[model samples]
Structures are given as C-alpha cells and as structure tokens.
Target: MNLPGHFHQAQYPKRARWFMAIVWALITVKCGVVWWAMPHWNMPTHPIWVVGPTLIFATLVTILWLAHREE
Candidate 1:
C-alpha cells in the first residue's frame, strides 16, 4: 500500500551546518568574554544586559533550525 500523496522534505547542506556551528561557537565565546570583562571594567551588572541577548539569540537559533528542518 502507498500513501495518498508525495511529500518533499527540506534539505540542509553540510556547509550550512558548519556555518551555524561556527556562528554559535562565536556567540558563546563572545558571551564568555563579556562576562569576564564586566567586573574588570567596572561595568554595571544588570541581569537584562546578559539575559536579553541570550534569550534573543536562542529564539533566533530555534527559528533558523525549524525553518531549515526536514519534514
């Protein structure tokens, strides 16, 4: 028996995966550096400063992953 219709899945290239990996790595490193610098620079330690970007980044990555996901 066969299904009623044909379905096409989205394709994600190896290069795209590598690019995203690098992007996430860089973001992680940047966050670490920011945390390391905050105290040394005598900057104000506000929760929003760190958490806001992190949440936004997470949301963006989730959207990107879902958009490129295979059906």
Candidate 2:
C-alpha cells in the first residue's frame, strides 16, 4: 500500500534495508533478554508489560515496511 509522507523500506537503498533488519534483530534480542531476566529479577509486574509493546511496535513497523509501495 502507498502511504503518503510515510517512511518505507523500499524507498531506501538495499544497505538501509540490511541496517533496518539488524536493528530489528537487536530489538528482538533485547526483548528476549528482558523476558529471561524478568523472573530472576523478581519484578512485580509480568514481563509482557515491557516486552509486549516492543514486539508489537517492531512487528507493525516491519509489516508496514514490507507492505508499503513506492507510488
């Protein structure tokens, strides 16, 4: 889909796509770390409170990046 005035991966060079992929991977790793450490830290709230939003944001961005067209 074409989204006016929005940033899309296709609008960027191949190098940028790679960079974005790396950034997303790092974010995933961060979520994983937070998930694993949450129990050990004995936090009152569940890990999902923190990791859930990050994952959702990342997934939405990634989907938009892939779905966007260069119209």
Candidate 3:
C-alpha cells in the first residue's frame, strides 16, 4: 500500500542528521565542561571568556541547523 503524502517528503539525510546529532552532543558536553570549569579556570574576571566560546558554538550550531533545514 502507498504511504501518506506527508510521509513521502524527505527530511535531513541520515548521515547529515547523524553528524549534526553528534555535533550537538559534543556541544552539550563541552558546555557542561565549561560550566563545571568556569569557577576553577579563573575566567570569572572576564565575561568574554565565558561568552566567547558560547557565541562561537551557538553560531556553529545555527549554521549547521540551517544547512540541514528542508528547502
């Protein structure tokens, strides 16, 4: 039997989705590490130290997400 129309459309390719999922997992882990280390790293004196990595990762995640979005 034929599938429903909505099921016919493709989503992100399997490889792309897996790659993004891996990246997302890594990002989350990195963020957790940063959160855990911020106190001992002497980064509290400069806010940029905290924000910089976060902004960089956020931008990367955004780019990856947009790249895989359906057009």
Among the numbered candidates, top lDDT falls to 2
| Full-model lDDT for every candidate | 0.66, 0.83, 0.63
Report the lDDT tens digits of candidate 2 across residue range 1-71: 65566565556789968888899889989999999998998988899999999989989987787666655
Give the range of the ten consecutive residues with the poorest summed lDDT in model 1.
Answer: 1-10
- Identify the runs in model 1 with alpha carbons over 4 angstroms from their true place: 1-10, 68-71
Ranking by lDDT: 2, 1, 3
Q: List TM-scores for all candidates, in order.
A: 0.63, 0.71, 0.53
List ranges where model 3 is wrong by over 4 Å: 1-9, 45-71
Alpha carbon deviation, residue 62, candidate 2 (Å):
1.0
TM-score of 3: 0.53
Predicted candidate 1 versus true structure: per-residue lDDT over 1-56, tens digit per residue: 22324333335567866887788787777777777787778887854598578859
Error of 2 at 34 (Å): 0.5
Model 3 lDDT per residue over 1-71, tens place: 22233432255567866886787777777777776777777664554576578869778765655544443
Candidate 3's displacement at residue 49, Å, is: 6.2
Q: How close is candidate 2 to the true structure, as a TM-score?
A: 0.71
